[model samples]
Target: MPSPLRLHPDRLLPAEPGLRAIARELYAAVRELPILSPHGHVPAQLLVDDEPFRDPAALFVTPDHYVTRLLHADGVSLADLGVGRGPLTEPAARAVWRVLCERWPLFRGTPVRFWLDTELADIFGVTERPSAQNADALYDRVAERLAGADYRPRALFERFGIAFLATTDDPADDLAAHAALASDPTWTARVAPTFRPDRYLEPDRADWCKAVDHLGEVAGIETGDYAGYIAALEARRRYFVEHGAVSADHGHDDAVAEPLDARDAERIYRSAYAGQVTAAEALAFRRHMVVEMARMSCDDGLVMTLHPGSSRNHHAPSFHAYGPDTGSDIPRRTEYTTALRPLLERYGTHPGLHLVLFTLDETVWSRELAPLAGFYPSVYVGAPWWFLDAPDAITRFREAVTETAGFSRTSGFVDDTRAFCSIPARHDMARRLDAAYLARLVGEHRLDLDEALETAVDLVDGQPRRVFRL
Candidate 1:
């Protein structure tokens, strides 16, 4: 017989009896609160269409880079896992499932294991631990569940208790699906698009000119000149706001946002448009656009979120084969203090601007990020993001930022997932971890039990809504 699989009721709780009890109490109070995912890669079309998901591998093993990256590291081929392939047949997909099950031991204590185990047991009702022996059976069971009405994407969205969902979208996107969902009387859930302008900022890229031309066509502003380009971006921001978006997201190479002189900016824009820009000129132009984005936020009331310091596509071969977000991206050391001074000096205190800064670099959390959030009314520290969204890192984030910025000044936990089913699992883990952290505070007498409980609830419900302006 297969070993029975079950999730511990207090899996992430503190070990001490007193602290465990307090954590359990705190968790119970906010365990079922609605999830507010303010920044994520989940496509708006998925929820809008309400289509049944494809297969087990397509749904779970393939789309999630978190799972694929690790498995690839263990000598699994990306093509075998359906990474770059169009779609996997049921048999082909089951082969991938077998790989995951056979190597279950490899994921012994990883967060991916935690999430998959939770999803299998809680969502799909898998009663046995997956192994090479039971991989086919587990795959069949999950496939059956997915074909059911309750397991459909919209049903799962509702079942997951998502109060507000934000999807990252290019500035040129029309948000047709978002509009469709908003007008559908049957769909009452709030789904909003977040304006993402990373492509427009990188003039050194091969497709930069084409993207600029596309933006001009969509926004009805000429891109041949710097003034018209700025107008086009501003127009898109307003369009997003009209469609219920409340935030603009930026993922740049760094956090620098210094402004260039108008003459220099115009010269560079003309050169970049002509496809003759140098690497240094491209970096300077991108940095300058960051400040311009801040200015746009101040004018339009859209929250500005900065995700910086990801060295994307570290492995050239894999990136070439699988394309970006195939999990080859790596993080490098990043300094925020000197890099953000230009932007901060200009709009750091602007009453209308809300700048939430995120980093893969944890070194700056206490030293730079916290202090910046504490000082500026507009600056808020983004939650532990990308590689730092694990249990230990989440705890460290709280410890690092709380003393300087406090709870209110920090953006709450965002799931930032593309796996539709993992939404609840991710949010639940965060809630449990937050409860445990608060329980420790209460136990230490640093915070009262009642206050800790209240704060725990706020972190789940109030914080995201307030921080993202939902």
Candidate 2:
């Protein structure tokens, strides 16, 4: 028989009895707070359509790069996991589940294991730890539950206690699903779109010209020149705002946002338009556009979220076969101080602008990001993101940034996930860790218990609504 699974009540609390008690009190006070997912990758159509999940593997394994990448590390083929491909047959899906269950031991001590354990036990009544012996049975059990209304996407959204969910979308996207959701009187959940303009900013990509032209067509602007392209983007930002978008999201190679002279920018744009741009010119144009985007945010009132330093599609083979976000995007050492000086100097203190900075590079938490956010009224430090969203890293983030920027200047915890079910688990982890951190402060007399409780609540309820302007 598989070992019985049970989540410990004090699993993430501090070990000291006094501190643990304080954490328990703080956690209890805010554990049930509604989730405000200000930034994530979950497609809005999933909730708009409100379909029952197809199967356990599809719901939990296939869409989650976190699971597939680790499984790929242990010699499982991405093909076998149904990645980069269409839906799998029932037997094929079960085979993927078998692989995950057989290799479950490999995930020991990782946050993946923690998230999976919490999801299976808490959400699905999965009481037995997964193993090859129980793989088929567990799959069948989840499949059965998924067929029920309780497990449907919209129902699960409500059950998850999500008060607000934000999905990242291209600026050119029509957001038909978001529009449908907004119009449906039956749907009460608040789902918003975030405008992501990275592809339109990159001139080196083969599809850059095509995407720019398409953006012009969608926004009803002429894109034969630089001014028209900028107009097209500005128009789309307004369209997204009309349909309930509050932020503009950028994921670039770095954080640099220096503006170029009008002549230089137009020259680079003309070269790019003619498909004759050099690599250096492409970077310059992209960097210049980032500055322009900040100016647009200052005018439009959309919060500017800068998530930089991801070396996306690091493995050519996987990228070619499966496309991006298949788990090969690796983080690199990033320096933000000098890179962001141009943009910060220009509009970092603008009253209308809210710049939320995210990084895969943890080294900048105290050295650069905290100091920048500490002084700038408009800048906010985003939560520990991507590889750093794990338990220890979350703790490190708090300890590193709190002294300089404090709680108010920090963006509340964002899940940044495509896996819908993992939303609550990720946020719960953050809340638990925050409670523990605050409990330590209260125990050490750095902060009183009442203040800790208030901080905990604000971290969950107030901070996200304030920073993201939800």
What's the residue-level lDDT of 407 in candidate 1? 96
Model 2: residues with Cα > 4 Å off, grouped in runs? none
Tell me the deviation in Å of residue 119 in model 2: 0.9
Cα lDDT, all candidates = 0.91, 0.94
lDDT of 1 by residue, 1-470 (tens): 88889899999899999999999999999998888999998998998777888888888889999999889999999998999898778789999989888888887777778888899899999989999999999999999999999998999888889989999999999999999999999998999999999999999999999999999999999988999999999999999999999999999888888899999999999999998999999999999999999999999999999999999999999999999999999998788889989898999899889999999999999999999999988899998887998889999999999988889998998888898888888888899999999999999999999999899999988888888888
**Tens digits of per-residue lDDT for model 2, 345-460:** 99988988999999999999999999999999989999999899999999999999999989999999999999999999999999999999999999989999999999999999
TM-scores for the candidates: 0.99, 0.99
Q: Pairs clashing in candidate 1?
A: none
lDDT of 2 at 249: 95
Error of 1 at 141 (Å): 0.3
